[model samples]
Target: MKPVDEYFINQKEPYQSIMLYVRGLILNTLPEAEEKFSYKIPFYNCHNKPMVYLNILKGKDYVDVCFVQGILLEKKFPILRNDNKRKQVRSIQLKNLEDLDHENFIALLHEASHVLSHSKKAWFI
Candidate 1:
């Protein structure tokens, strides 16, 4: 695939809204996260690797926000959905602004931030 700038950069309307929504939430949570343009997508990298990635593939109807380490969250928070489609990583779908889960959504972002903070502070084993 070409660089994200060549692919997603051309998306218009709804696709941009959904992708931006997730992107805004991620930036709001980790204000200092470094943005990465890799694998034809936008990845939020912290502590050197990605914490989450937002990809808007060509022709796809919805943009995807992928938690790079979502498997751990699935194990820690059993209440987190464990649908068959979420076998590897986890994601919250947003059709519009209304699809935002607010409270739990913020919590997930915090959890990702916490994981990165700990990994950097020697708090991780």
Candidate 2:
């Protein structure tokens, strides 16, 4: 199986389900997105640039859906959390499947893609 598929399959309950659901939403919203395993996590690329990634941090109870150009999206997506004070990346932390707002997440995915398409920042993997 693809490592990305294994990443989801290897996850324990709740986290596994949450990641799978978000993964589906991302692919459904951004059909052109390329899924890759990087930094040992599931990363999605848009416009040939890194756009987002998913991971369950060690000792954390939630799955982090991190937007690469979050600094730009943060202005419009106040729902994104900068708890870690990451300069460019912002994330939506999901503790359970119920925490996901499907419509909003989908919108965020699209907005991220739009931002990447217009960005000239020379962002790397």
Per-model TM values vs. the true structure: 0.72, 0.94
Tens digits of per-residue lDDT, candidate 2, 1-125, equal 99999889999999899999888888888999999999999999988888999988888889999998888888898989988878788999999988888788888888889889998762632
Q: In model 1, which residue pairs have backbone atoms overlapping below 3 Å? A: none
lDDT (Cα, 0-100) at 4 in candidate 2: 94
Name the regions of candidate 1 deviating beyond 4 angstroms.
1-9, 57-60, 75-88, 119-125
Model 1 per-residue lDDT tens digits across residues 1-125: 54644545576768777776677777788787877887667888777767878765455555566776676676664434434365555655555667677777778878876776666431222
Which residue runs does candidate 2 get wrong by more than 4 Å? 122-125
* C-alpha lDDT values of all predictions: 0.66, 0.88
Which 10 consecutive residues of model 2 have the lowest summed lDDT?
Answer: 116-125
How displaced is residue 125 in candidate 2, in Å?
14
TM-score winner among the candidates? 2
